[model samples]
Target: MTQSKSIAILIADDDAEDRMLLREAMEENHLPNELFFVENGEELMDFLCHRGNYADKEGYPLPGLILLDLNMPKKDGREALKEIKEDVNLKHIPVVVLTTSKAEEDILKTYDLGVSSFITKPVTFASLVEMIKTLADYWFDLVELPKNPKL
Candidate 1:
């Protein structure tokens, strides 16, 4: 269950501006991968679970990496992380916490919940782009992610 190759990166953030910025950064960095977006944790879970509209597997492929934002409406990232880590099939996917909060408690909590990494959202667009490059380099280049079992 060895998605070593560059696979789709799913982002679950409530902020439209943040999502747009992330997309722009990925594009600016020329990351050759698909980018999927979910507005909140509920939507994120729905996407991952392939429920309802996401029932079509081909249309919504399993993500190799998940960039999860900590705070969101309707089932926050913490809850989503708990569910994902508890599930046998979904636990394999790498979940990186990318959020604006730099609280130690949040960090500790997410790490304890089994998040692969926790990244503080950069304020500036340039800084964000740099972060995205580094993230792409690490996850897509250096690290070998767990293979997508659903694939």
Candidate 2:
């Protein structure tokens, strides 16, 4: 499969275990895209806006896609998602919700907040590997993302 090596992926999840698992899954899938992680929604926003420690754009390049979790400390995914969608500079980047919550309300809410897709976290490691592979294929290989002038 053709991979977009230049496009990085940012994941916002409070759970360290989940982040490690996702990294493992991505490694298993052999995706060429660089993966970055943030433990909270606030950090995610900082990374996106290039504030605080993320001020160096070369060190923390803007992600082409974002995988966000619903529950987080300091600023939940919903709030962060709203802020991202409202910002003209960030709205173009696709944000996907990959959370464990199967609540219909969360699904509807995220979509309304301009999330590209909402996916329930897979239960098994094997399933996660498959999901990561599919996600990489769809976003990097199939989809045509907008060129960020800022980058």
Candidate 3:
């Protein structure tokens, strides 16, 4: 595993338990990352653009990858995704929908919005660990992530 530069993972989820469980799974997978948390799409964008409370670069690192949930407060993932993909500055950052939504329409819409990948969240912690490992392997190890200028 690459150890020099820790990757940043931005996760937007309303559920606190889900966030804790996901963090535990990430720990189990031994994924070297700096995890950023946002409870809603609006916060996610604030973090991304370094606006408002997220303005400090030291406090909010730009995400190397984003794990987005479809349902959120303020702005939903659908709106946030469209905005991100449409903006050249934000579009370069890869987005992966890690959502609980199994709806085909949601899936199709997200893909059309230009998500790099999508995975439905599993029920079990062990399963989540496996999925996280696979995601890490594919995105961090296998795929050549976009080269974004460091903030």
Q: State how far residue 146 of model 3 sits from its true place (Å).
A: 1.7
lDDT (Cα atoms) of all candidates against the true structure: 0.90, 0.93, 0.88
Instruction: Single out the weakest 10-residue window by summed lDDT for candidate 1.
Output: 1-10
Task: Work out the TM-score per prediction.
Answer: 0.95, 0.97, 0.95
Pick the lDDT winner. 2
Q: How far off is residue 94 in model 1, in Å?
A: 0.6
Q: List pairs with backbone clashes in candidate 1.
A: 2-147, 3-147
Q: Please write out the lDDT profile of model 3 over residues 1-151, one tens digit for every residue.
A: 6631567899988889999998999889877698989999999999999999999988787888999999988999989999999977889888999889999999999999999887899998889999998888888888777766766
Model 3 worst lDDT run, 10 consecutive residues: 1-10
Q: Which residue pairs come into collision in candidate 2?
A: none
Candidate 1 per-residue lDDT, tens place, 64-97, comes to: 9999999999999999999999989899999999
C-alpha RMSD for every candidate: 2.4, 0.9, 1.4
Highest TM-score model number: 2
Q: What is candidate 1's local distance difference test score?
A: 0.90
